[model samples]
Target: MRLDGKVALITGASEGIGAACAAELAACGARLSLTARSEEGLRKAGPGALITPGDLTSEDTRRAVVERTLERFGAIDILINNAGIGSYLPSWSAPLEEARRLMELNYFALLGMTQLVAPHMRARRSGVIVNVSSIGGKVTLPWSTLYSATKYAVNGLTEGMRVELWGDGVRTMLVCPGYVQTGFQKNTRFGHAPDGVVKARRFAITAAQCATAIRRGLERDARTVVTPRSGWILVALSRVFPSLVEARMAKINGTA
Candidate 1:
């Protein structure tokens, strides 16, 4: 629970879940090294911190983040892979190249960053990775298949990682949140959504609520974490009665 003096690196730290996490983690007493494309936003997270403004979609930028974190903090202890993009169009309708870019950030960059950090954690035999995924990773819906697919990839990555890191003393976890009230959805590039869907999504849990759940997951070292009572209840029900849950979610997506 206490992260006093721990060095943490947070991607997508300019705003939304990343910024909220920076605030929460800083309050928990950890020094933060935050990265995003926004220098101004990163500056706002200050309190004995280092901020890096770069595109996470670039391999060079991703590695530089790790290198900068190490150079600034001496060693990386916690990595919150919260940087990602959402596509709001149908996969086929979406631009192939744009989707590739999405994959670069949502899947490949996360994997590469983890690969870069895991060995260091393995060397120390201790570290925590909190990959920010989404509830759509756990199920399918109408449009947004590509966006969902990327999150699904994150889900798979997190699971396989836990197996590999076991007994190596490295902890890997996936944090899946449902319709977090953030600019991510509004600013999405593809994976189309109806206006009704967007409206409903706006009323979902706040970033702070999701960040609180993330802090708990890090503290407890959870395998997978979900935010808000409704989110977990749905995930649980999906496991308990998949068909029923699917039928219900279908209605929510207006697919039924």
Candidate 2:
């Protein structure tokens, strides 16, 4: 996936990781098509990009975004499924509607965008799909269980796409980022994260750093990318010592 001169469509390009990716990809000489709910923020984040400002949860918006990107660039060499929202409510107690809405954007919308672009990529037999999941997807966050669920779904889908699309010459990459410095906490759709988790921002990587990792992953044709690298240690620990990890997470959520 040489980014130079390639057409990359990125969702959630308004601010945070998506915005950072837009800039990073452009710097790598990729042509950009950016979509988000904020027209103004997209403008700032992706200058000279084909901006489609709308809700990704809408089927029409998803279609128009893919159609318009092809209209402008003639081909989509890369798809970055980055548009997603978070929830802090416990899965058992959260409103069903809120949980549904979270899944709609974080999981369903991502799947919809992939479905729309996958055919074109398969036709060409060349493309990369990048799904922006979270470290929470690998090791669940007790405080944000619902949010973690969406990311876990993303991880599953990305893995499946990798195998399913490999014969077509299409590659899929899963990005699991640990606490990137962004407004994600402030902009979550539901309740706030526990104070301990919020205070952990001091140790988090910047969105730009996360974006850089994504770009590197694309260049190397990686299957999975865990930003900050060290996040993998946590993931490994969770797998080898599930009860220990759960206890620590419960403490972070102030539940123990």
Candidate 3:
């Protein structure tokens, strides 16, 4: 469970939580392979980290990233599927194509990368797969329904894979972070902040905080990580008081 000298491949490493995870893991002495659509922002991952800059939604890109990571490190001890896209519009009014595009990057790309890396992890009988979902995955947010749906799928996939890989000595961690300060909101498709979103941004945590939780989860062999320590209360409320939770979400989305 010690990350020292272990090789970790992190997607969406150009910035935000992904970059933070790379830096934290490197500080833990883990060798890193960082991937993103652009190389410029990846420099924050620090020196000597392998950078695979490309579109992760493409099969060729996923394959190349894995192959090259293996080529350099000989084995992947950890796989962090962090590359994702999000939508801020209401699902019913959103363009169908745009929804599908979000799914392609957020869900399918995560699945594709896991599939490519799982066998190697299984063969080695020791590895970790971290899927970066969201607090929205645990509790649907009306304003970003489609984005929530994609993350919900990731939650399910990670849970199932965790059980499947249990006996193989491979581990899966579901990271459901509350709102964090990052360029994520700015980069989201059709993601202009509305009044409610603007109000919510005031409470967002920093990306480094989320990254710290992820690293600690890996060390402790945790199944789920809810960042800022308090996000878990929302998850619990969603489970025990679904109606109330939905009402709160409605209020937050300015629909109440």
Candidate 4:
């Protein structure tokens, strides 16, 4: 609902969309508790923003971040599960362990943080949980199959959680962003993007645009938010013409 004076805990708060969310929320009058592996980056989020630097894959780190946030704010009005890794490896040859690792951060960690913060939100009877998925979640992207799989899991979980938490006053929102100009590609957990994929970055939106959509979605208690607005056209196209979409994706990714 109203963001004024609310306390939000955001993971992956160091840079990119996460940093933009932190700034946007802060401007909305929400206090922020930010977590990431970069202390320096976290500090840049804002002077008043609480910084919890650590690996999100670790349960200990998750616990510590939540505990510290609660200890400082006494309540968590918003939980933004924005910490995630990307994989560009082809499923046919991608290592299983790497897949698992990607899931650990992208899906499992999001689940863990939600599990920890949900009870608190339920008890308060007023809160929001924002899961940052990707447009890939809505439509599978070739050569990044595992990444899409993880995001698809996010999309599913956010939906289920939204229904399960209905009338609980705890809103769940899913943010599905198209390619955004961020360090995501350079820091991918496994495999680099093909030349075609890299070239596609030319049309990517900025991280701030994605963050703005996320903030607006939270304010409106939206069920799902697909950023770059036009991305919705692609999602709709995929649903209406799956074969055409798949064939095009395969060609774009050099699969066929």
Judged by TM-score, which candidate is best? 2
Better of 3 and 4 by lDDT: 4
How does candidate 2 fare on TM-score? 0.99
Best by lDDT: 2
Give the per-residue lDDT digits (tens) of candidate 1, residues 69-149: 898888888999999888766676777898898888999988888898889999998899889998878876555678888
lDDT score, candidate 4: 0.93
Better of 1 and 4 by TM-score: 4
Instruction: Please say which candidate is ahead in TM-score: 3 or 4.
Output: 4
Report the C-alpha lDDT of model 2 over 1-256, residue by residue, as the tens digit. 6889999999999999999999999999999999999999999999899999999999999999999999999999999999988899988999999999999999999999999999999999999999999999999999999999999999999999899987998999999999998889889869988999988889999999999999999999999999989999999999999999999988999999
Quick one: ranking by TM-score, best first? 2, 4, 3, 1
- Mind sharing the TM-score for model 3? 0.97
Residue 128 in model 4: lDDT: 89
Clashing pairs in model 4, backbone N/Cα/C closer than 3 A = none
The collision pairs in model 3 are none
Query: Cα deviation of 112 in candidate 3 (Å)?
Result: 0.4
True-vs-predicted CA distance for residue 188, candidate 4, Å? 0.8
Q: How many residue pairs in model 2 have overlapping backbones? A: 0
- The lDDT of model 3 is 0.91
Candidate 2: minimum summed lDDT over ten consecutive residues — where? Answer: 180-189
Off by over 4 Å in 4: none
